[model samples]
Target: AITQAEISVQELATHSGQIEASNKALDDIAKQINMFALNATIEASRTGNNGQGFSVIANEISKMSRSSHEMLGKVTSSLFRVKEKIDATTAVFATSHAEASRGVELGSGLTDIFEDLLEKANAANDSLGSINESIQSQFSSLANIQNSSEELATVAEKNAASANMVASVTEETAAAVEYVTRSAMELTRISESLSQSIPTAKMFDEWQPDDSNEKASQ
Candidate 1:
């Protein structure tokens, strides 16, 4: 989605360039038309009686040229503002994409930690099982071994709880990333529609975990 938004921005920039060029051309044409109208009026005045109709035509042409010039000026101004806004929006999207990428990275790292924690928990549980067998075989050593087993079991239980917490957090982060993705997609769609409507006038034809982010966000 970020990539698509960037492409849309580039395309918008291209269209802006086209608009600027067209506006410049229109300004030049309007100037020439005004000059022609002025010359025609002067010549018509010199022609006396026969020049009355020519004078009217020259006046109308002058009025039309002025109107067109004003209209083109307004359009150019509007397009400039639009271009500025699109540039700002592109910057914002770029920042958001970066933040979202970082979030995915963090989420992935957290998932790795969870895996490691679970592995350690399983190892402690297995050692505790072995200690139980030892206690059964060596009654004289039961007191010492029992204390060690209790401590190991406690550590294993705490680790299991921690792992569960980490899993819950990972799930939440995944959902957040998914939400961001959907939002980005919606924004891209909006920009695309806006770009399409732009040429009509011319008629020319983020923020959050590594594992959750990497898997769910994409």
Candidate 2:
């Protein structure tokens, strides 16, 4: 648009000058023809035979100047049209430039919004990653607890068997103590005749007391 405006403005200025130059050329032609007319009049009076052709030539020059004037008028009218078109086009160019600038401003705003959204998206992604990591840690902890519980169950089974064995040993020890007590009671009943069970003191063969045994007895 700027280029168009520059071209149009240059064209209008250049064409206006052409109109002026055309008018100047026509005016100069008219002046030259007028001088020729005066010269022809004087020559016709002084040399009647030679002046007829000079008069005709002067008339042709006048006619050509009139034609030039008519052409100049046409050129001037066309220049006015060109100037009006250029002015209108220049206004259009100015309006278009304004609209384009507004578009640029809108584009800038959209770019800012896009940048903000990108940042928010990145933040959300980071938060999600943190949450995912926390979930993973919790899962691992639960797995460890499950493993410990399995070991505890195994230990409990072993402890139950040990408790059963200890109960059996306790019953056997109680029975042995009861047997020992019964034997002690039986021994108390037969203890007074216990020495007669030994036969070592009896004289199996017609035993007579020797003189030394009698003395000892005394």
What digit string (tens of lDDT, one per residue) describes model 1 on residues 86-200?
4454444444446556553534643443344334323433433442332233232222322332332333333443334333333433343343334334433433445453322
Off by over 4 Å in 2: 1-49, 103-218
Global fold similarity of model 2 (TM-score): 0.32
Clashing pairs in 2: none
Q: CA lDDT, every prediction?
A: 0.41, 0.35
Task: Tell me each candidate's TM-score.
Answer: 0.44, 0.32
For model 1 the local lDDT of residue 93 reads: 40
Error of 1 at 17 (Å): 2.6
Best by lDDT: 1
